[model samples]
Target: MINAKEAFLKASTELKENGIENSTYEVREIFKELLKLNPFDIDFAQKELSQSQEDLLNDAVNRRKMHEPLQYILKKWEFMSLDFNVRSGVLIPRQDTETLVECALEVVKQNNFTQCADLCTGSGCIGISLCHYSKGLFTQGYDISDAAIELATENAFLNSCDRFIAKKHDVLLSAIGKYDIIVSNPPYIKTQVISSLQSEVKDYEPHLALDGGESGYEFYKAIIPLWKNALNKGGYMCFECGEGQAEEIVKLFEVNGFSQIRTFKDYNKIDRVISAKLL
Candidate 1:
């Protein structure tokens, strides 16, 4: 007999008490999904909750209480103006990664690169967004994890980026072709730092996508040389980096023959992107 508003408030309060961040928004979204009601529609409805709906809401609340990621509970996430299916095995696309996409697009626009590669294409967010934003640019995305490749492929189709191809190939071991532009938001969080991350990330997200080796620059080290070999002269490479990691990544690129290196900051003024062109 509880009204929708009452249920939402109760759920929100419970979630907050359990240390879940964004409790109100999480509860509201759960209510919306269960009742097929929007936030505004919650108050107008007088219908009783169905048994299945009640069960779903309760399960979701419990999961949130455990500090599970909201995206995992919902089984989907949004990035770059598109919806993507996500599960525990795949790293959820984050807003900060969009900065990598924007920077890559700018490089492509400035240099008119017709082909690009998205290394470590988790969920296909970068490559798919590139194809969506860059007209006539052919994009190829590579991931070492099979699950990541499957999910990225699904995301590509979901975003209507059929021209974008997602492949399973380890950047560290594979021989890749030269590209005009290459962008990656690779795993940059140091291995030792993984356990200290929020539960939503360390517990729920895939470790394969979060651990960047002991120094958190394993992928950067492995890819820089490969990128140097794979990018045409004058082609560009961009990486989404963790704070304090941009300079080290830039040095890697520079030592491997990249030039005109530069880093771009996110809205918070933290350096989040590094860009350079092949010599």
Candidate 2:
């Protein structure tokens, strides 16, 4: 029977050979999950694996070999200091998106926008995080997909945003009430680029949460104008954009009559958030 250390090394090597970039961490998380033992736990240090435990490790190894996202396997993901439940149909919350939340919080803090809307609020990460951090704001989250709405509500509840409402509303067609701050990390990966993404994203994640049309700015184009009437006068709009999209997104807001257009960079210095106010 294989021991935990031997099992982990073998699984890590196999995952690496299959192109998993973070093989060691993946293997460690898998071991900790299956054995219910932390890496530093004395029990893990002394335990011998039973046959069932060995089989579970082998199953996880095989799943990893198939390029399944570790987050999907774990059914949870972290964003903005919170853990969100994730399934195959929902977008996996990403750290890059935290920049959107941060920008929104800062805008509200600076301008005192207490009513906000999170459009295309998959998993409710943006609005929920804002509610958690902003304290006094009333936040609402909307998504077109029923599955996404369900998961978003669950996430909102988990994050203690019971006052935050998650609803099913397609941004392309729905008429939402005015808000002092509007924000989204909408689907922005170009349709063509979707197929070219790493398998962990292209294969495992929801296409509805990706596939941002031919030029990758369809949602921004469609929603920015709709938001023109939905934002209170002098209210702010902020969005998370894909790489190389900040300038075009700023242009979209400008064309829609938004002023004071600004772009902020993520920690990696990528132009990741675009902010503007209705003139």
Candidate 3:
């Protein structure tokens, strides 16, 4: 008997009580996803939700109340204004990482680079975005998780980035082929501090994409040396880092024979991306 707007308002209140920051946005998204209709389309004020749709709404609200991510619930997200498929077990693309992509684009354009290796590519956001922003750029993305690889591949196809390829490989174990650029947003959250993060991250997001080992630099330490062989002379390397970790990652790039090391902050002004060039 409840109307659509009434149901949404109730769900939003519940979400607010649960401390979800994007409660209002989540409600609109859920309506679009579950009901095949946008809440704001055609003035939902007078439209009553069907019984089945109401049940679906309740389920979505409860899931969010339990700290599940809205992206996972919607099964889609946007990166750099491009749509990407999202699901559990694969890392969701964060807007902060867009700073890394933007910075890398400058290097790619400066060198007229046409090929890139995206290590630890989750959902192929970085690699796919590069190919999108620059025509003729080919991209290869690698990840250890089968789910991540599969999702990344699907995203490449979804975005019509035919030159993008995703493979299953751990950056810590081996290196990709030489490319004009290499980018990664590897797990950088410290092993110990992961548990203290927000429930949306600690409880819902994949730990394999967040844990950075004892010093929050295990992947960086392991991949820098290994990736050295895959980077061509004068090629660029870039990374998305946790707050305050860019300095250490720049030092790692320096240790591995990279120069012109620089860092870029996200909109939040947190040190988020670091870049360097191979000497």
How well is each residue in 1-279 modelled by candidate 2, as lDDT tens digits?
667667767888999999998999987887777665466676564666788878888888888788888877777878898878887788888888888888889999998778999998988888989988988898888999998899989988788787689988999886589899999998999899888899888888889989899989999999998877888989999999988999999888888888999998898999999999888
RMSD in order of candidates: 1.5, 1.6, 1.2
Q: Which has the greatest lDDT? A: 3
Which sequence of candidate numbers ranks them by lDDT, best first?
3, 2, 1
Candidate 1 lDDT, tens digit per residue, 1-279?
556666667789999999987898888778765556566763445656666766787899999999998888887877888888887888898898888898998898888888899898988888998889988899999989999899988888888887699999888886488799989888889999999998889888889888899999998998888667888888889999999998888889878888899999986889999999888
Clashes of each: 0, 0, 0
What lDDT does each candidate get? Answer: 0.85, 0.86, 0.90
| lDDT, model 3, position 197 | 95
lDDT tens digits, residue span 214-266, model 3: 89999989988888788888888898999889888888988788989998999
Model 3 stretches astray by more than 4 angstroms? none
lDDT-wise, the better of 1 and 2 is: 2
Summing lDDT over every window of 10 consecutive residues in candidate 1, give the lowest-scoring window: 41-50
Score candidate 1 by lDDT: 0.85
How accurate locally is residue 257 in candidate 3, as Cα lDDT from 0 to 100?
Answer: 87
